[model samples]
Target: MSWQMADIWENIAQAIPDKPAIVDGDKRYSWAEYEDRAARVAQVYTDHGLKPGAKLAIYSYNSAEYMEAQFGAFKARICPVNVNYRYLEAELTHVINNSDSEALVYQAQFAPRVAAIREQLEHVKLFLEIADGSGEHLDGAVDYETALQAASPMPVIERSDDDLYMLYTGGTTGMPKGVMYDHKTFSSALFTKGFEMREMTLPEGAAGFGPLTQALHAADAATRSIPACPIMHGTGMWIGAMIPHALGGCVVLFDNSHFDPAALWKLTQDEKVTDLTIVGDVFAKPMLAALDDAQAAGKPFDLSSLQMMGSSGVMWSAEVKKGLLEHIEMVIIDSMGSTEGSMGASVTTRETTESDKTASFDMAETTRILTEDGKPVAPGSGDIGLICNGGMVPLGYYKDEKKSAETFRTFDGVRYSIPGDYATVEADGSVTLLGRGSICINSGGEKIFPEEVEEVLKTHDSVYDCLVVGVPDDRFGEKITAVLSVSKGTQFDEGALNDHVRANLAAYKTPRAFITVKDVPRAANGKAGYKDAKEIALNALNLEVA
Candidate 1:
């Protein structure tokens, strides 16, 4: 039988019941206690009439209860949907409605936003709010702790490997959609040994799993990991929450709404964190800056216990990775993956080659480059193709058949997840990822779709037309830039345009800089010319293409 995540957690809890399972700020939960808390949360959901397989939306900052709610949903065979806390009213309402969420669990700080959209979300039958040091509370919403304490702990329900693990991801279409994956496939991507790590084979079968499970508990000391990114993201949740628990280790979370390098370093030294996960240069740059400042101040943090530091989603520059290696003699695994697919080409700083630094990656054995004609492109062919992952992929986007068909396809009788990433297989068989074909802007690991920003910018009174593009940056891998064609004789007000976008969408999606153009360039078919807009922004910013 294929292993389910809930079952795996139960097995690990049985093996290491007294060990710390999760440490969030000042709060800690032992393995046994964590399971008990999850059971209570699950019972609360059922008591509220949330049935098995019902969808629950988690909308909050990184917290222990956020994870408890997630595991509880898993225990109850309920699907938990990750809601980006950065989303404003419109975006939040769209996702909650699209997911058919029956219940919403959100932080009290975001109560105003939720309250604004509550009238539109008729399907959401229950609201559970966690106090965020704010005295604010939404009317008619149940307190999270009150509900958890009142409910009786329920027995773990039988779950199949086919249980749903849904992740809502923003795409080039300018809206967020849920990517659907069964627990079996998700586990294969997260837990199974990759081709580069070991022999490429399926995860242990039922017959071979007994000894492995026993050895997993007996042979290894308790490991500790800190997820520097938000748990709402795939990298943070998997590396920080799920993977550690699955391995019977401890997951430490910083108790802050924003990332703080000093606090993160302090926790690492204090807890002796074994694993650390980051997202590209946005995280690495600040961390390195803080480390440098700490050493100069004569109180260098002892990160000796850190075993591995990894990044996913955005680009973790080679310079930053090398700097991190100086502080700790460990490899930096710069994983290139998305919510739609896992384990593509991972660029590692293990061997430290001169040229193969940041964007270059060693393709996984099952990963391949397929041309538009559905033929495998040979290495060094100089042909651009979609970087695809074969075997045990997601089912498809929930309720979006058009996108699901476009993303997951079958070629030569084998199905693969083609996530719209353009790459070239180098002569040495390494892959040099060009970028996303969808033109998604990644600013500090946050995905910002150009159309989403463009739509907002065009709504400005001074703006007649606009196109948004990503420009290279030192801190954030890419920053948002907007090229505009204002109304005749109307001057561009950057502040006004920025505030417009910030009011309508997440603040991060707002343009950092604006450039006036003669006219917004468009093709004959009336499509925005992103290439031209990108060049315009780069020239205006006086940045050279690296």
Candidate 2:
């Protein structure tokens, strides 16, 4: 079916005006209220001189206001750029200015940071702050709710299906790049993936949106998804909010800034949520701990309502998935993809999990593994190639044509998005993802993917979390080092870790040293960040890293 999220959501608002759209803490907003508030946000953007094709960046946590502001940009036919909330001054300025953001909506807590760089970001013309009860406000900034109350709801104008939808890179390796998608391309993928998750197909014609939503609601198939990760990120927004909203489902947001597995479980129980979105093991470990603690306390949560749990962006171990399955008896989805384009995912239920392996995923229809010379890799030939995606790919990075051309290209007359993720083709038409090539380690002139070693470390009981990095070594040229985190007073044996790594992978891939840190570096969205880990490893060797 040909439809845009803006038009479909607007129609849903008219058809089911009283349906719950967003729930943050004790606050609830229905479809009518959601549309009205988003329209007011659009009015605020208009009043600040933002027009179609202008960019509006959202730098905030998972809150009702965040999604409302995003939807407002969608309605205005403007690009909504996501800003990482954990960004410092320079990073903040780079993102806002790089995206050509004319308007910014941020949380009150980040006002000082924004103020520090306000002069540096010449593109920003308006600043709107969402209150966090800190009373911290940016100078000359508009209060979010106050502006909504004062301005009239903007009239629903005809928005182009070609309006851009941007998702900035996580910036773990370098400065973030904005990946742009026209609403038509993105919305089509959204519907296709949404229906695929439900084992359904999109009905034909322009009038299908309302009926599909109503049917799902009538069948109690409408999801109540709680995104435990940051809403500013892709997984949380796409799988957490957008897809659920498309099915006329309600999205629940936790009030706290930090992740509390116990609280997330409590909220899931209280909301009777059907889906929970999270980043891989960084989120799953603590959540599993919380579940165990509750069971020990004889006050286990009522997770019976939970039907599916999805994780992306980082490594999700098979052990964690089995642990969660034992408790909730729900489907666990491990997605292997990036913001640029999705390749595929692995969904595990209780019966199918015995063979559950880490990082092995079924391929999407348009996904392929191609060698450097633009030839498809033969299945089970033990040849490694870059994983490329074709259908519904991005337009390119916002303004960087060089990087865009390198990533999005036509190989053998078919356009594909090759984002530097190396994998091997399996005999069963699957791809065994070997981490990103940019960060792969070259030790003794042998290429090694960190994900393999990291997953091996995670299998150890004493290791809570870890990041593997390469440090300069005199003999091997580069030493594989592992930075790890564990519970206080719990220690790991280096010999045992080495043995474990050797058992799973070759001796060359085993980490030479292990450094303990209170916490491993990860992005706000829980994706592994190696910049800090490399520095920490180099510091252990008295070698400078910068």
Candidate 1 TM-score, true structure as reference: 0.80
Residue-level lDDT of model 2, residues 1-546, one tens digit each, is 436567778877877788888999878999899999999999999988999999998998899999999988888888899998888887888899999999999999899898899889978889999998878999899999999999999998876777788999864467889998988888888678767977888755235777887888888777899988988888899988888888888999875478889999999999999999999998998999899999999999999999999987688999989888888889888888889888889999999879998888998889989998889999999899999998879999888999999999998899999889999988987888888998899999999999888998998888899999998887988889999997545677899888998998988999999998889998878888888889888888798653
Q: lDDT (0-100) at residue 321 of candidate 1?
A: 75
- Clash counts for all predictions: 0, 0
* Candidate 2 whole-model C-alpha lDDT, 0 to 1: 0.87
Kindly report which residue stretches of model 1 are placed more than 4 angstroms away from their true locations once superposed: 193-220, 347-355, 440-546
Task: Kindly list the per-residue Cα lDDT of model 1 for residues 4-59, writing each as its tens digit.
Answer: 77777776677667878889877899888998989999998899899978999999
- Of candidate 2, the 10-residue stretch with the lowest lDDT total is 202-211
